[model samples]
Target: MKMMAMALRRITLSPWQTALTALTIPSTTTTTTTTRPHSTLMSPPVVSLDLPDVWPPNSSHFHFPPPINYSNGHRAAVIDGKLIAEEIRSRIGSEVRRMKESIGKVPGLSVVVVGQRRDSEIYVRNKIKACEQVGIMSTITQLPDDCTEEHVIDAVSSFNVDPSIHGILVQLPLPQHLDEGKILDAVSLEKDVDGFHPLNMGNLAMRGREPLFIPCTPKGCIELLIRSGVEIMGKKAVVIGRSNIVGLPTSLLLQRHHATVSVIHAFTKNPEHLTREADIVITAAGVPNLVRGNWLKPGAVVIDVGTNPVEDPSCEHGYHIVGDVYYEEAVRVVSAITPVPGGVGPMTVAMLLLNTLDSAKRAYEFS
Candidate 1:
């Protein structure tokens, strides 16, 4: 019987035969007994039932195991941008303290705001608060909403040559009359911590030449992606939106990291098809829910840059900030997705402080 069982095990069984054996065998049985044509005595089964399937079998029967859930899995290391920024700021503050002790001068950051847009004001105030907390000298130059482009440019030019000021940032979304391009170009590249200068952009585009400062918001986005361990090298990255502020620089940065990048603008035909094929998607279109759930590939990493405020009467503020990608829809599909308000926004402010600190270090040559 054991010999018969061994012979039966040696012969490859069909799926149906295996199912019949399993169905006929009792779960509590320690061994199987069978009779062969030449032998009547029963013997122990020679093959162990615990053995797994051997290779070179039917190709149609093969299937890959399901992927492990990493989006909500236990992270090996938390990418706390806020904590990292705090550590960087503390280091900067200590260095500033040392510089003051040695050279009798400290780094100063000047913020220029041309309008009273509530959001802009809050951003500027937050920047100033960050500077104060870091012990970096901060100054705010506020101009009326009616201020001409000439007035804004003159203020920037003055800060450009000021020996005491190490960094300068001009709040964005200036009054409609102001030529934002010209104003940004007016700030000296050395002090342009906001990194909107044409020279900085040119250097950023060039190979082997690093920009004096990368734009804060885009820098933050890249930092988040990298620290989260998302693979960038040799992956397809799609950036939606081409604004010089975020999309263009971000695409360049991703290219620097060796990603195959494609930039899709408002006019791009079949944007959803392109996004669906990407391993990574970065949306800065400022259009609410422009990147739908179906546009994302499974396991793709999503970075949402838009912070559009839509009316929400249930909230105390009567509005809620949303990203270009629909959060509810994206989280269900993508491997990882960043929240709108708490995602890239805080990191942007943090990177601004980092740039300011870099400007200070460069100005004073503080080791």
Candidate 2:
């Protein structure tokens, strides 16, 4: 197999080799002297060809481990999303306190949850708890699972007009009976803190135009990479999955940072090949273990956005959340890999609060 691989590599370069050899020729030297007084003779430029005695000769070999060290010694610093999130919330709390003292108004975030999705409920609860921690008023408008589309739209419209509600988020994956798109559209651009509104998405897509809010998960991923001092500019980045909420927007954001981005979707052939060639890989495919160790380049930074719950007989909950990456394999190959439950998930909630605080600051002219 190794011999075949080496043969293929050589065959692929033969055409270029012939072209290069055709352009090379022996050179002869000549001496010339200027007519001006006291001018010295000069030799013609010598173009020497210094070819190695053997092509493809071995000089030195070096091994570079993954950029991130996940050993127990450094595991404590792998990144505590929960702790960092709390720090951000505390900062927001102080800002909120100051805003209330000087402007007499604190930021408020209203969440409209329709139907009963257990996971959605948990997410919403966490968001509310985060709001309370940051001193931001939290309100939840819960509607019945059987509620009509009009009812949901009306709730969103009401929140849109309420000056007290600076940010609004409608829990996703609404009932099958409702139109998710229309309901999300009803949210006013200014208060669409989830940043799903077409207007907001458009603003984010346009060059030189910043959206009032960017989607929490993608923003969090970027923040994680940036905070880690990852080099993004001019690097080859591959984003697996093309969903508007994560993959596509994430690629666009990376592009904004001047990274050459290749978006891979289900139809792409040999997706791993592309990923292995990338310097950075962002996977939001929601499939556990979708990416493996051998598919990564050494020192590559991996951001796993999937939060899939897999049955785990050993776990107390009978299941556990895992990211799209095969963490064990990835940690060995990648320089840094975000864990499933403690990575992007917590960051998402943190960024939501950030967007809320930003909205508040803008609404009250406190910037």
- Top candidate when judged by TM-score against the true structure: 2
The 10-residue segment of model 1 with minimum total lDDT is 50-59
Off by over 4 Å in 1: 1-84, 313-317
Model 2 TM-score, 2 decimals: 0.76
- What tens-digit string does per-residue lDDT give for candidate 2 at 3-60? 9999867865355344444444323222123222354523222332222112112212
Q: lDDT per residue, candidate 1, 137-219, as tens digits?
A: 89999999999988999898899889889888899978888888989988888898888788888888888989999988888
lDDT of 2: 0.78
